[model samples]
Target: MKRPEDIAEQFQEAWNSHEMTALAALFCADASFVNRFGHYVRGVQEIVALHAPIHETIYSDSTMQNEVISTIALGDDAAVLHCWSRLNIGKAHPAGPHSVDTVILAVLRLLPNGWRIQALENVTLTNPRTGQPVLRT
Candidate 1:
């Protein structure tokens, strides 16, 4: 099995590329992902269907960097990830930072195939009205 850092980096790389198919390949068949927008997608099929179009259109050129704050093994085949990420939507360098603060708590399950993300809950760290950063619950 790959290290958690390696697995996470693969996910980030897939997302940064906006390749939904590749991203979907990292999930378990019945995986679920909840976004900061309060939307929940169930299963890899739904995840690919619902999750990719937005990134494909809006974040095609965006770059994402994530800091894995921590990871705790729930058992031999499962674990959780707490991470913080910033998305740079354009290539205009640091000044063009339309930073989207995020906190992701993901549940990963080892499958016969490989390490796959079973579930993920993503939340935004910002004030919706003013667009100022705020702590999420």
Candidate 2:
């Protein structure tokens, strides 16, 4: 990646393409992730396992748009970033064709090759009062 901030764009592309291998390449071998539905897993392989099926099923036709909200350098080798993403749910998804907004917090580490995600957490935007998913605020 040319810049640390580029991870969001890479993620967006990989997700839209439904290429789990490409997505796995963006993370470290020991990377950890928490999906919007609260499913947590450690290691890139596990992450791939968790995501691969979804792309074949619920997310087959989904497309995501991600905007980098912030990127904070923790040190020379580490950084933290928040990306706001909007996903257009596919017809195959149980939710049907709908759009959802989410915030993704990712920790990135500058590796020998480049920057890779070390940990990530995704949370869906929701209405606090109604406990319903929020398309937008």
Candidate 3:
């Protein structure tokens, strides 16, 4: 059984290393990703495709940190995790990295590929830039 801490660590590693491929591989074939900006993507293919461009341009020096708040095991095949994420978008601004807060809720299913992410949703924090709604690309 993979603990929430382990899952959180893996997520952190993926973000820190900017390992989009590895990160996508951690999802189930039909996994769903709901980014901070409320963009929802389903399946590994879409997830991978969508991340390619964003990973290329964004987060040039960003670091993602997630703190697990709770985990609820659902039966023997599924679990739900609630967490908070603080993203430090790197020093492109005069003020240096800006902090963005978010709440993430994810569903994980035990699969042959291990504990893959089945679904995810996020409640985003305010975007300091533009003062308008920040949409995840």
Candidate 2, 1-137: lDDT as tens digits:
75789999999999999999899999999999999999999999999999999899999999999999999999999999999999998799986899999999999999998999999999999989998988865
Candidate 3 runs further than 4 Å off: 92-96, 126-137
- List the candidates' TM-scores in order: 0.84, 0.97, 0.82
User: Order of all candidates by TM-score, from best down to worst?
Assistant: 2, 1, 3
CA RMSD per model (angstroms): 3.9, 0.9, 4.6
Instruction: Give all candidates' CA lDDT scores.
Output: 0.78, 0.94, 0.76
lDDT of 1 by residue, 1-137 (tens): 37654556777888887888888888889988898788888988998888666675556578878889899999988899889877667644344546676888888887787777888888889777998776433
Tell me how far the alpha carbon of residue 119 in candidate 1 is from the true structure, in angstroms, after superposition. Answer: 0.3
Task: Please identify which of the two predictions, 1 or 3, would achieve the higher TM-score against the true structure.
Answer: 1
Backbone collision tally, model 1 = 0
At residue 31, candidate 3 shows an lDDT of 89
Compared with the true structure, the alpha-carbon lDDT of candidate 3 equals: 0.76
Q: Please rank every candidate by lDDT, starting with the best.
A: 2, 1, 3
Q: List clashing residue pairs in candidate 3.
A: none
**Candidate 3: tens digits of C-alpha lDDT, residues 1-137:** 26534566677777778777778867788989988777888999998887666556667578888889898999777889888888888775345767777888889888765677888787876667865545343
**Per-candidate clash tally:** 0, 0, 0
Name the lDDT value of residue 122 in candidate 1.
Answer: 80
lDDT of 1: 0.78
